[model samples]
Structures are given as C-alpha cells and as structure tokens.
Target: MTEAAQKQQSEESEKRERSPGGKFMLVLLTGFLLAIPLFASWLLIYDRQSQSEQAEQSIVTGWGGQQVFSGPKIVLPYKAKVQGSVEQDGKTVTRTEIVMQNLYLSPEAMTFDSDIKTEVKSRSIYEVVIYNSNVTGLATFKLPDDFARSGIDPATIDFARAEIRFGLSDARGLAANNMLSVDGQPLVLQPGRGLGETGNRGFFAWLDATDLADGTITVKYDVKFRGTESLTMVPSAGQTNWSVTSQWPHPSFTGGFLPKNEVTEAGFTAKYAITNLALGSALTSTQASQQVYPQSNNRPYTSFDSSGEPSSVTINLIQPVDLYDQVSRATKYGFLFIGFTFVAFLLFDLIGGVRISSVQYILVGVALILFFVLLLAFAEIIGFALAYITASLATIGLITAYAASVLSTWRRASMIGGLLASLYAVIYILLSLEAYSLLIGSLLIFAALAGVMFVTRRLDWTRTLQKRPSS
Candidate 1:
C-alpha cells in the first residue's frame, strides 16, 4: 500500500474510536454490566438483615417471648348422666352412667388496667424490645337464674368445686408471687388451669360458692409478667373495658380492635370497650366454651379469627428508625447514581475536549457499586446516617481523584465531586422522606434532563466525526 493511503486509514480509525456515537454505546454497555455487582451487593445486604433477625429472635427467646392473656374466668365442675347402648352377653343393653364435665363461665362485667414498661435488650448488632407489665383487674360473675334451661339442673351444679382460672399464652412469662382474691378471701393458685374449657397453660385457684345464695361472685387479681415485642388481651366478659399505658413511644396498635385513644412521643394511652352483642352469642354457647378445653381436640382460639371472635387489642413496641430498612432503600437507587454520573463524564468528554476511555467508565461504576457495600458494613457498626455519610465521602474522594487523572484538570474533577455530593444529598433526602420520594425524584430527573438539553442545544453532532490529534 502507498504511504498516503496508510496515513488516511489510520486517521479514519482514530476518528471512529473517539466519536460520540461509539462512546454513548460503550457507556450503555458498561452501565448494564455494573448491574451484576449491584444486585449481588443487594443480596448480601439481605442476608445480613436475616442474620440480624435471627439474633433478635435469640435475644427475645432468652427474655420471655411475646404474651397473650385470655381470661380471669370462673370455671366449675359438674356431674351429668348420659344414656348409651352397650353390648352385654351378646345382646344390646341400655345403660346410664355419670360423667364429669366442666362448665366455663365468663364475668358479666370486667375491667383491666395494664401499665407496661419497655426496655431494649441488645446482642451484638441486633436489638430486641422487651417489657415488664403489671396488670390488675376486677371481674363479677353471676350464674343466670334460668341456667337449668340448658338441660342441666341448677340444684345439681357443684358450686363447692368451682375454680377461678386465667389463661396465659406463655406461662414462662408469669412473674412469681402473684395474688388472687374471691369475695375478699385470698385463694391458693395452682399451676394447671382447672377448667379444660380455657387454655391448658395458666394458673387456677379453687373457690367454694355453696354459701352464696344469689350465686354472685366478685374476683380480683394483680399479676406481673415479662414479654417481648407485643402484648394481647382477650375480652371474655360480657362488657369488657381495658386501659393500657406504655412508656414506649412507638407502639403499633394492631389486632381485631383498635385503641380509642392517642399515641404520643413520650408514651401511649389506649382504651378499648367491647360489648357482648358485638362478640356474638356463638362465643358464649356451650359448644364454643367447650372448644377451649385442652382435650377437646378443637381448634385453639386465636386473637384474630371468625370463631375466636377476636374481641382483643394488641400493642407492638416498635423501633422508631430501622437502619437496615433504610440502607436497603438507599441501595435501590444505585443505578440512578451510576448512570447519571456516567452521563456527566460523557458530557465532559464531548464538550470539554476531555478523553475518557470505556475502561475508565467501568472502573467508576464499580466504585459506585462498592459504596453500597461500604454503607452496609459500616451501618452494622454505626447507624444509617453516619454510615451513609462516611461511605459517600469515601466514594466521592476516590472517584474525584480518578477523575482528575482522566480529565487532566483538577477544576473539572472538582465539578464531578460536586455533582456526586449533590446526588448523595438528594438520595439522603429521598430516604428520609419515604412518602414523598417518588415525587421529589421525578422532579429532580426532569430538571436534570432539561439542564442537559440546554447545555448541548447548540452543539453539532456532525463535527464529532472530524479528525483530531490524540491528547
């Protein structure tokens, strides 16, 4: 080949390599490749969060788990005769036998007052919230005068063997030295709930009602217990009223019923009132009452279900700020950060006569993805805000220094640093204002698009193919 022809071929190849079209395609491909590391980093953050949850569970298990209170109820044992057919001497014979059964009764009116004090228990990087609850209440039970209408004789009712029972979901949470009283008489509490109609795990106390002609009994008790996360109470009385006060500022009131009260920064005060009519008669029927027995083989009562009636309220002690959740949210915007910064570099390459290779762009993207890893690691030691700030500063400094070498000017490199700083600030705001993040992010993107359009309004793309000397 001629020397002139070889020179022309070299110039054409050089022009194509530095063309705006070629650089744009390379940036797009680099951005796509960067997603692999970004997603891998997100998975790592998720795995760490799961580990944190496991740590919290361990802490809560050691400290009594969550608690649910079913009742401070009156239960009585009675004898009934059942007639059945049996085979005797190769012939069917009718026999009558006496069988023992339990009659469960709830109070006509009941009132509960609970004072809950919460504390945080931490293990390593995870923390669990637990509470010591002091509860006191009064319940009044009166046998209906027409009780014999249910195929049972009132005179046959064994009032002497009557017992007062209370149900607790986790008996381990019960504090020692609890007290119970029936008609101003102190009674001894036993371990297992005497009434099979109630739950199996709880305390019961015997009370003789033979001398009481009117069949009216008043009971009172004061209980102290410890639990974690949440506390729920079942309203077993015809008319139930509950007043709960807690020192925890962030209490999430959940369950079938909501508190008709207010929550404040210092604490929360919740009140609940439930009526028998709302609870439905099915809950008070003999079949439903018998279902609570430990040997009934029936589905257990849940705080929120059709059969259980769920006439209850629950309060969850929640953390005000969850750092893991915030960090995860920040990582979701990783692509935007990388793409926008790459676009800024491209603009500098196109307008400012700076030459940045595809490899340099990929290196900058990798550094941007590393920021999330740094944030996650630091967040486990420090908090979200400090970790974010530290990671952002470190990344900005590294990328800015690299930019200075590639762009050949400290002034241009400073511009890239300022742009990154502004982006980090915007992301922090978005993270803080979660409800308005979409609106703010959309407006910021629109403004960026407008700025880019204005800056390149007079540029001619045809001139991009013109040959220029290598820098």
Candidate 2:
C-alpha cells in the first residue's frame, strides 16, 4: 500500500475507536437497568429479616405484667396409698393405696381466704414442684398473719435448693451410695441445686421437694407446663389481651393473636402458665398491657432500641449460623459467581471477537450481581431455592438477549446464553447448599478461571484490550 493509503487507514481506525464510546454507554445503561432487581431484592427480603429480629428482642426486654405470687404454700389432701416394701430378714413385703387431693395456693393469697376452692388430684406418686424464686421478696404470704390472728403457730417450711435427678439403684448407702440406673445412665439426683443462687438467664425453675429415699425410688418430676398471662400491646381499648406459652428463647402465643385494628402503638395481650416445674417449681407469670409503645417510640416492630441500634447484632437459631459466618458464606458464593462469569466472558470474547464489545461485559456483571440480589430477595420471601430460580431465570434471559443483540447472530448469542444459564444454575446450587457453598463455589470458580487461563495463556493482552478497526 502507498503512504497516503496507510495514513487514511490509521485515521479511520482512530475514528472507529472514538465511536466505541456509544457502545460503552449502551453497555453501562444495560448494566444499571439490570441492577434494578438486585436493589429491590435488598429492600424487600433482608429488611423483613432484620425487622423480625427487632420484634423478638423487644418481647424479651419489655417483660412486663402484674407479677403474682401463687405459692409459698399448698395443701395436699391424701387418700393414703403408703406402699412400703420393708426387707425384713431378706424378705420383701409391699402394700400401697391410690388416692390423693393436693390443694396449692400462694401463702399471700391464703391469708384472708381461708377456704381453698381449687382441687388438684393425682395418682401414682403425685408431686408438685415448687421454687423459692417463685416467691417474691416484695410479696409476703398471709399464712403467718392469719396464724397470728388465730393464735396458732404456723408451720415453718425451710426450702433448700439442690440438684436432683431420679433413677433406681440397688440398696446402697444413703450418703454416696450407688444410684440406681433406670436407663443404664446413672441419673443424677441433683445437679446444681443452690437455694440462694441465681437461675439460668432467660430460664428459671425450682424443685418442689428433695428426694425422700435414695434406694430404688420411683420418682416423677414436673419438667414442662404451659402458663398464660394477659398483656396489652395497645391501651386505647382499656383492656389488654395477649398470651405467650413459655418456651425457651422463643415462645408461641395461644389465643393471643396480633392486634386486629391498626394502631400506631402495638398492643399485645396473651396468657401463658408455667410449664416445666423440673427446672423451677414456683411459677410466676407476667402479663403486660400496651407497655411496648412501638408507635410512640417510632419503632413499630419489636425492638430494644427505637433506632435499631444493633443493626449488625445477629442472632441465629440454627447452630453454626453466626452473623459474620453467614456473611462470609454469602460473600464466598458471590465471588465464585463473579469470578466464573469473568472467565466465561473472556472465553466467549475470544470465540466471538470484538463484536461482543465491553458493553456485553458490563451486562454480564450486572447479571451476576442480580443473581445475589435475587437470591437474597427470593430466599427472604419464598425461600432460597425459589428465589434462586426466579433470579437466575430473569438474569439468564437478560444476558442471552443482550448477547444475541450485540453479536447480531442468533446461534452465537444462544451459545453464550446457554453457557451463562449453566453457570447461574451451578451458582444457585452452591447457594442452596449453605454448608458447602464455599467449597463448591470456590472449586467451580477456580475451574472456570483455570480453563480460561489455560486456553488463553498464549494470547496477546495488548491486542485483546486494544480497539480494532472495522474492515
């Protein structure tokens, strides 16, 4: 070619490079447009999760109610079934009966009310579990006061805290004798029975009485029982109606439903009776009336702080699910997806040439980001599997369409689209397998990157990133 022709060719190449700006703009626009779903996903799904947590904390901190002390005292009416087996001269003789009525009342309540109205009857060794913690220091039982008025000496009941477990053991020494094994495991008669010690946080209980005999004792303990209390979420109605069944950590409400009318402040009402006397015997229930004040505080949900201060405070019910760990899990999955997409993009670029443009790359990145956003959103609303499908399908469609348009060839576009479809499907599978997402995602990402790296090891980078003149 002549010098003039060569110079003309260089000028044309410069002009083509300048015109690629429009192509870049188109790619960026497409990417931003595709990111809409990702943004939406963040807003809808994760937001609710955070809110639910706040509600949970509020319930714990605002534990309110008319604290009632029901029992430093109870009456046990018995139809004497004294089954005693005395080994007289190595011979066994046993006799027993079956009938007993136990009347239990708070010492404070029994003072003025002399007549016991409620009747509780049990057969086969009925025992009621009582705890000292159930008796409030602020509330004194009226039993002593009544006895003083009646000029009768009241019986002094000294309660002791001791750990107790029950099972059968052969005739062993009472102090440090062999405990009977009921289920092959030596049942501890008492574990941590401290009369004046604090109970486990968020959990409280007391034993009704100590084990009477050590050898071959058939014992029954009250471990779980449901209690009911009325609480008010909103006070405008002048009555509170809320109930909670006492379960560890999170309790379910029976008959205590969410408020029907929409009010600024949330009013909760429910009743829960103590269940599980084995842990702590004396029971006290709390029923609060509209003490939450969610609306006035500007936090309509259950939260300790109005501003939701501990935004990062993560409380996971599942074992091994920590806040930082979950985030790391998500991050690992995301990195794998993006890294794979990058490799795939580069591979497709080599096969299809500059015709695909950097705009296509931007579109692919947007699609990858959307996968995460969609996964998070759908996982929140529906679940991880459904959300992943929705997001992956939408993103794959967007990528395939963009690829087809940019390449201007149905076959080429479809091939790239299929490749992306496969990639996203793998990513979703990784995300779903939460325990192994990191391992799978990492392996897949490395595989893709390695494949691309091996295939393009001999390629010239200067030319790859450089503008090519249209023929």
Clashing pairs in model 1, backbone N/Cα/C closer than 3 A = 196-293
Please, what are the lDDT tens digits per residue for candidate 2 over residues 332-395?
A: 4544555455555545555435455555576577667766656664554554556557877887
TM-score of 1: 0.83
The most accurate candidate by lDDT is 1
Supply candidate 1's per-residue lDDT for 173: 81
Native-to-model Cα distance after best TM-score fit, residue 14 in candidate 2, in Å: 4.3
Model 1, range 1-471, lDDT digits (tens) per residue? Answer: 999999999986785555676677778899999999999999998999899888888887745777888777666666678788999999999998776666667778899899999999998778889999999999888876566566766566688987777877777888987889888999998886523323466778888976443667888899888899899887767888999998789999887778787888889999999876666532222322342344544223323457554556689988888878888899999988998899899888777777777889989999999999999999888988899999999999999999999988899899999999999999999998989999999998999889888987877654554434434
Candidate 1, poorest ten consecutive residues by summed lDDT: 282-291
Model 2 / residue 27 / CA error / Å: 12
- Candidate 1 lDDT score at position 185: 93
